[model samples]
Target chain A: MTDKTSAKVWENVPSPFCGIASDDLRIEVCGSSVRVLANGDAVTVPGFERPVTDTAPRIAGEPASLEDAVRRAAEILKEARLPVFSGFGTDVNDTRAALALIDKVRGIFDQARAAGGVRNLLALADSGWIATTLAEVKNRVEVLLVFGSDVEAAFPRFFERFVWNRETLFGQDPARREVICVGRAPSGDAAVSPDGRRPQVVECDPRHLPELAAALSALARGASLQAETVGGIPVVVLRGIVERLRRSSYSVVTWVAGQLDFAHADLTVQQVCQMVALLNKETRAAVLPLGGQDGDRTASQVCAWLTGYPTRVSFARGFPEYDPYLNDASRLLKDGEADALVWVSSLSPAPPPAAEVPTVVIGRSGMQFDEEPEVYIPVGVPGIDHAGHMYRCDNVVAMPLYALRDCGLTTAAAVLAAIEQSL
Target chain B: MTALSFTLKSPLRQRLDASPLVPDRLLGKSPKEIATLDLQYGNRRIAAADLFDIAGDDAESVRISGSPKLDFAGRGMTRGSLIIDGDAGAYVGMHMKGGRLCVSGSAGLYAACELKGGIVEICGNAGDLLGSALPGNKKGMSEGVVIVRGDAGDRVGDHMRRGSILIEGNAGMYLGARMTAGTIAVRGRIGACAGYAMKRGTLLVYGSPVSIGATFNDCGLHTLGFLPLLLKGYQGLNTCFSETRACRSRVRRLVGDLSVQGKGEILLVA
Candidate 1:
């Protein structure tokens, strides 16, 4: 650690850990230790304060040099017939490097949070959706309809930063904004208006979201239903919500894809998107699919720009081939189709999945594994040790991460590039 | 003439793109030439001779001793016949314009996807998106006949514009979902949300469905004249629906989904 007098304070620092990319963080960094000085929440504070550990590389739990570790990783991947590059929890540059490496190795690339993002992607692939960004939600949204998501739990400052802002460009009072929660209600009062108005909650089992979404869409299209209640919510109450959405000039429907955990959840997302599309005929409405934490949006955006498709892509056929179900990392590993696993997680200490194949992990410094992998390389956190670009949940803007300390740990991009060079 | 056959030397360690082995693509190639054809096995391209023991010479009729790793077995085949003796991987008959593709064992996801016109018969269970469109495509299986002797996973006829999918076993959730026009008949139980957001289609279920969507309004029971004709169309095929005892004209018709075009009908045999 450096001297206490050498502490450098950083203002307006953007966070790469949070899905929203919260930018107004005030942090103080002394040597390798960092602290969130102001404007920190439960998610961002712990993210910024994670202490660096295990700065050296290890091969089968034995201390090794960086060159040896990368060479070992490459040798293992080179011997495998089918390799899977999973746990893509890194920033943009890192993801690009990993994709390049995977392409060269002719392996499969899948993100850790791909299962959640695929819910939205499957719907988008079936019937495209119109979505909005954080700016639109902050300045233009008059009615916010959330579906089966506890917004505050995932995004701590979502309402505080966007919904309940001080002023808007359209001259609409932020306090007058209407909030409605369907299926799952908010655990906290973040959705409550400054004028002491609680958000209208229509509670029901999350599994029935598909039916409720269909009901709402039907009601919006002026169709009558024979059933008195759909998904345990009365039809009359759903009609009232539909009427409010129709009256509002700008309405935004949002859901955290990870929260909808049931099977075939993409159909529910499609129903919600279809509802938004119908509402757009007479008024302005768009769906906002959240959940970009752990660099999911960053990896997807980078992959799409380089490749025509999102994640679950394979280069085994000498070209980029995409099949969301066929290229699933977990299924491939479970089926013993993959002979090797290359796991990359730099933002958090989340360990890679336990696999029977030869595993190479390039993860956060403190990541612990149930069993020692074949190769392990401790990497630097993007915002903490190295500067990088990370896309927000909205997928419109990529925030620039600033390095707060000169930690000896290297970035994931550097390690992956080294491995590619060895290959 | 004996059909050209490719027998697997061993269980595949990596997925093999068997698309090049289709009849139209390998029509006039010599035995030596066919042996030298490069097949994609994982990251490396290996000769067909390395993985399979090629035999026989009838190019129009081809046979493959399939493994679960054999993918794209009959992709874009315009003519001739291709048969897999064992379980086939994903995209068993993707984009086939014409010809007959048969898989004697279970097939993986997206089987018969985007099939323009063909006869695809799977003797065993089929994975999800049986006759659905490729990712981002608007139409799925525009013209074809798909017969699955065993259960089919979710989204059986998703986005299908025109086709007939006959499943002799149970079907998973979202049967005939978002389909524009098609006829999907399942002889066994169906999962939830059948005919979801369907614009126009007919889903015939001989067994009771687990749950029907709220948007589908029950039209009560009716004696339909077209039911006998529809069942008769499958008479020559090796499907239980072709049996004389199964050709009942009386059924329960439910019209939905009001959420979309609301023209699709689910006929439950009474």
Candidate 2:
């Protein structure tokens, strides 16, 4: 005997949990609970069905009114000589409002989920990047190259949403697309293609990604090599991979920037870009640098348009000054350069970075804190509690976030805007 | 042509975006209309007259004197001449299709994003993403000429479909990265990952070069056929390229980026 209630089904709901930003999730809301129907993977369920809790604001571990909380937050910021505004796990509007608050306080701005994004931005800044979208990957990609990162680990539903689809508008057989995994290949069970085909595995050390990428680039360029093996791949095997890419109608080289642990990790990305560029000379090739979870891309996009800088910006001088290496929140806090922190994360359950200075946290409703801060304001979940915009991992398309239910909680933008006004 | 000028009277408290104050948009507008043009200062949207004192009325040639934290000074201008007498802000001459924009002082990031055609010259340093795409766009600076007299920040000529960028001073990393086709010549030392993922282009580095990425191969000493023509194209520009005309077509060419198209070249001044 089970209890079932009438549910309202919503289609094409975009999941902001991962970098893929799959928009095909079908959400079925019944009463206070929700269920993901179409393309509802393990990640999607938890990402959308997060338990709503803590509707009120708190100050010093005690429940407080919204106006009192705003006034207290403004007092902290106004008194702080060096304040770091970080943990940017909110939507586009929230980021804009946070920026406004940061400007008023003359603080530094960074992201909690910024390591991977910062590295990628450095790569992009170091050498320009070439990227493609999910639609392009689904329709045109005939060959896929995954370097140093397990595709499933980062974007769990990547294959299901963009690769193993039952219907492709281009009429290309999904089974025909070749997947090439380089460096730390996934096990047989984990590596099974969605279409039941076997993907080619190039077994190599993940640390040697730079060398492997170099060898692959040399092979793609048709440089005659005397060695039988390069970067642990046989010359013949490398040639075969190159030949397939040369003949592929469209090829895509993808990697998770955060997965790369090399001292000069961007070098590996550069090599991959070079390899893809070479392949494009013969046919058509593009790069898919995936990894922008927790609205990292959205934060960077909003920051760039508003201040002409992506992240790690200091407004202490009354103008946004960008310095990726210097303005890192953790770094500044640890070095005692920053005297306070304004941590904002409306999705992740992760806690704020511990610092000696006073911290004001505005985070997910369900987030649990190990050490209570000076003030904690629980904000609504973007794409669930409030409607907003978030940039996809590709950073090309920005999907609209939909509000599923009327959860009586304040939005991060509203709180931050209020704080600015209070200040 | 008669020149219209706006001299800043005071320092700005915030960034002032003057994208709407382009020459083409002001060509037919009266002096009063020009002063009333919209401008964005931080979150506040103010008018041109609020920031600067306007004098004369010539849209074909407009000059902005003093810095005042102005950005996008000559943005999206087509077929006109604009001059900045002092330091400028970011995105100067951005998306310029056809015009000549001269900045007497430094410029900030994305100075010439997605430029179709124009001549942009910066006498001082330029920030990152010069002649590159906007944040998410694929291609950058498809057609244009960008000359930075001083040092430049990273990712110059990144993902450029077609264009020419010349930096007289040292440049930051990723010079000519992901370039489909273009010409970028820097006389100063370049940071790491120069010509990375370059499909088809020519990156001439006269200074000490940095990591050329493993994808590139030393093609050895070879006489490039395009060098002379390329140098001759900038003959009258009074750049380092014009001074190297005596070298003829001879250059220490390292043809590579063999990883992609292998058509792109990283040439060193012999």
Candidate 3:
């Protein structure tokens, strides 16, 4: 090991990529590049290094001053009769500032992850369910029931950081932890525990999760099923799983609502919630619905705090009105309800929406546009350009985004605030 | 207690967050100090005196007159009273711990949200999620009273834990949704899904209900003796509830949310 005291290191750097928001990463800075020392993987490599690329502000495809670009963007928005603000892939303060602009422009607000966001809030409004924090799951969770989703595919570092963790403060052995994946095969042929043990996965159709949940809930309630197999899984297998759940100290059912394939998929989510509730009566159980992609939760939280609603809210009536179905970004763009668009994506260098309208794009420096927008402003990434806050997937807590370097770039919040002032 | 009043010179050009200008911050301060207080206008920060003309010095009672796009009127206030003579913006009396907040004109979304104690009264229409929890927060309005004399928007008292929300006019859908413990009484017609997903709460509707959620099970109509006692509690609160004593007639009580706990109940007065 290179002299421990001689190398420059940054400790406790929180990553904003995944929903886990693990803050135990230790990074070693070598010029413009960084080498993640502790708890670093393929996900963290790009998550930490990509934001350091050069970016600039432009007006009509030509490089321009930041002030000039903001003024032009404001003028465009002021002239629009209907505007849609989407692709909110940034931090909390950025969303708050963008909301101000949305209000001023009488625009409809949404995020790239609006599909899952709508389902999550609708499920919450339809029925309240119990949830726990990440710490609780990492330390005390004995059984994890993943439904309809390959959690490892979405959250690459989840098992390493939480499930198969080696240094659990609680005495629960990681080797003995039970991880059951239903409706999808575990990505890695086999899921190995910290102490080299493989867990069983049930093969079933993802669409049948709702039925499976109902059947399992009934089984947990001591009801007998007439059918020998339900949802293509043998009743005996389900019974064995239920026995394991009851024998465990604490169990958590997890799923990514975004990955559900059915339309109005919140119904399936309701069933999952029901299963957790039913299991709680017999043993300690809770649901962990994870989907914090592209700062969706952060945007919802900011919008809820200001307008008392989640996304799909329109300030066009001079008063905020929320309609999850009517004001959906996809519907608005398809039906021509929104005549203009402002896309903000500072965390990831994703392309802007392909709507046939005047679009103003605010993205990371290295982002490439298929066709140039009316105006483009490249802002600093949240964890690199400025310190900010983001909510974890569990929605129980928010983690801080640290600024490791000053790349002389303005944040999306600053750009939107400037635009708001101009308007 | 003297009265301190702020009269807007003109309508606001942008949304102004007046969360920092609570009674506690202005109580012991001089006129100059009060004038120099900070307020967030859209993204710009401005002094208090720049937006409105100030008058009086009462700390216990504060009245803001005129129609400025002001929000967060009494945010996090623990004591005293705040009065808005004209239309108030969103989040009025948000997370307020104590004291009284009264709005004479229409109040915006999230009015009296997540209130822990004290009272909030709006004479005009109120917007969505009144007495509801902030997004991601599980509990809202753990303890308090909210009275809206006019119509109310959707999801009123959503996810409320413990409190009482009284609406004299019609209310939209999902009233008292997912509430663990609370009392929601609507004197006018209520929209669909009243007491939806409610684990333990009492929802009293005095008018014709559109529909209740599928999870609720009707327990049949009955003349409850406690109706008079419940009405007596709101006697002097508002004139709208003055006739609550007449609700001693038979009411249909439904218990439900069978999908979850199924312990909550909704009582419809005939």
Candidate 4:
């Protein structure tokens, strides 16, 4: 099912489809890292193309394979739910990256289906969803359900922005509002409310999202929850939480940064959505699907503006298009199909080593250079070399760079400008 | 005033010992006025005119002519361009802001160090830290683009806050140490850490990763719409990034730098 090497033409590409570079294979080595990908047979790189060696396995002009990983996405997506964990087991830095990666992997199935190829696909269609900013959260959201996440680890300012502070609207401080945390494990982020009452804990295995939903439902219905207790909390506290949620004028259900996996989290997401819908029946409420590339939201926002979408796109038809699996870097790396690359970034000691293909680069100043590329372009950091803007974790507009570093290079805007001119 | 010119001299080492290169301050000085230096050769003071002949009178833009083997040609230029027609010295355009400087020939090490904002064009090859911050400083070229037709040495943009960087040729290593916000597109194959310690930034590539650390999780692929816009003017990208009209409806996201609180992302084509 991964072999997408049917030599499909670039034009008339359907929606929800990824693309391989066709018709033009001239590659330029940009100033960036080399990554290998392999999955679908859409494009073949005849060699290993590992980053450790120049003579590893490499085929210069082929697109990386992005197939062979949809099934695994079911498991990988499980990682998207632990943003509220206060332990040492977390491996990923940003939960959004994991979700985006899974979505891309899942996208392979959608693309295959679009091409009339048979594959199981997860339905992403959902009902209306509501969301709020971190600022409004302080005033409006008095009841917080820290489900499957660890705020202490994922968000440094979760308390400062969401919980502990006094708000003008909600008229409540941390002690007044109700904070409930439910996860597979305990969370330090779920500390006792400033009023000296310990936050209720329901330590059920996160995988049993259905059970959690049922518990919440039972509490909402004024019935005794089937489960006696969860996360070491008494059933009475569970009832109290539901009561508080019912009585609150405004409320919010927050997500952890990592719960991107659909296996266990899909039900959770639905439940949160459902809870929002249910809550709205009584009062104003919203859900905050927390976790995005911290500042990458800016890139996502700008990219969306440029290509009318976020994250990934292909330009085979002289226009822009998007497909998750077909464009994922990891899948491409496994596929080993990039002929050359223009790796753009500004957050490393040097470039990321990759397949022995020619490449180009755009990033912060003083980047180390390798001899594999045809060209290297040095750009400025957005705020430092050039003043640019970004979106905070909660989608808030963040402050621009306070000062510019001392040297040459412009901003991403210029690089885009140059790329436009080049095309 | 101080107008440095190396129109055609090779005694740069000896002459450089006697200079007071406050050219901007010497805006209204006479020809026979004074060209001094606050340099120390084993703890000794001298004059700048002793090296290459300083020219020009009232021009705000400083010019260093002649094929002089000068070092530190355009170090820390505040608001100007260094047009060197011949081989020059190190720290070219170091800490520059708002101006265009061109070096017609080859250059020494640490070409453009810690450039805050400006445009520096090195027609020839350059040394290390071409567009990076100085040692002990976490900020590199915060703004501006350094176009190097040749290869760069190493340690570029260490701890940059924001900006865009493009290397026309090749780079040594340690590209972006800890960039908070910005985009860097290398026109050529580069060294390691392309997106290492990135708090938030985008690193695109045409080739595969030579070596990837655990810091960046391998999220799958997703099509981004910004490619064509980024590939617009470059010839190579014209072919590699022809409009496909395909977009990644879903993308895999990797969260790393577990060592610190970071939502920085590094995306690659899957």
- Number of the predicted model whose DockQ against the real structure is largest: 1
Q: Give DockQ for candidates 1 onward, in order.
A: 0.65, 0.10, 0.03, 0.01
Calculate candidate 4's fnat: 0.00
DockQ-derived CAPRI band for the predicted complex in model 1: medium
Cα distance off (Å), candidate 3, residue A423: 0.8
lDDT of candidates 1 onward, in order: 0.90, 0.79, 0.78, 0.44
In model 2 chain B, where is the ten-residue run with the lowest total lDDT?
A: B208-217
Model 4 regions lying over 4 Å from their true place: A1-125, A184-197, A209-240, A259-267, A347-359, A365-378, A396-404, B1-270
lDDT of 1 at B94: 92
Model 3: per-residue Cα lDDT over A1-423, one tens digit each: 223334467898887777678788887755445567887655556767664555678887998888899889988888776788888888899999998989888888988888886777777776668887778888989998888787777777777777877757878777678888877777872356766677678877765564565456556655555556756788788878878888777998888878875654564576577767777877898889888766777778888898988788888766787767556777667756577889998886776778888889888887788898888998887876679998877775788998766557789999999999988
lDDT of 4 by residue, A229-292 (tens): 5434556765676677778877777765344343223323544565566667777777775543
Per-candidate TM-scores read 0.97, 0.63, 0.61, 0.40
Give the clash count for model 1. Answer: 0
The CAPRI category of model 2 is incorrect
Candidate number with the higher lDDT (2 or 3) = 2
- Winner on lDDT between 1 and 4 is 1
Which structure is stronger by lDDT: 1 or 2?
A: 1
* lDDT at B68, model 3: 34
Better of 2 and 4 by DockQ: 2
| Window of ten residues with lowest summed lDDT in model 2 chain A | A186-195
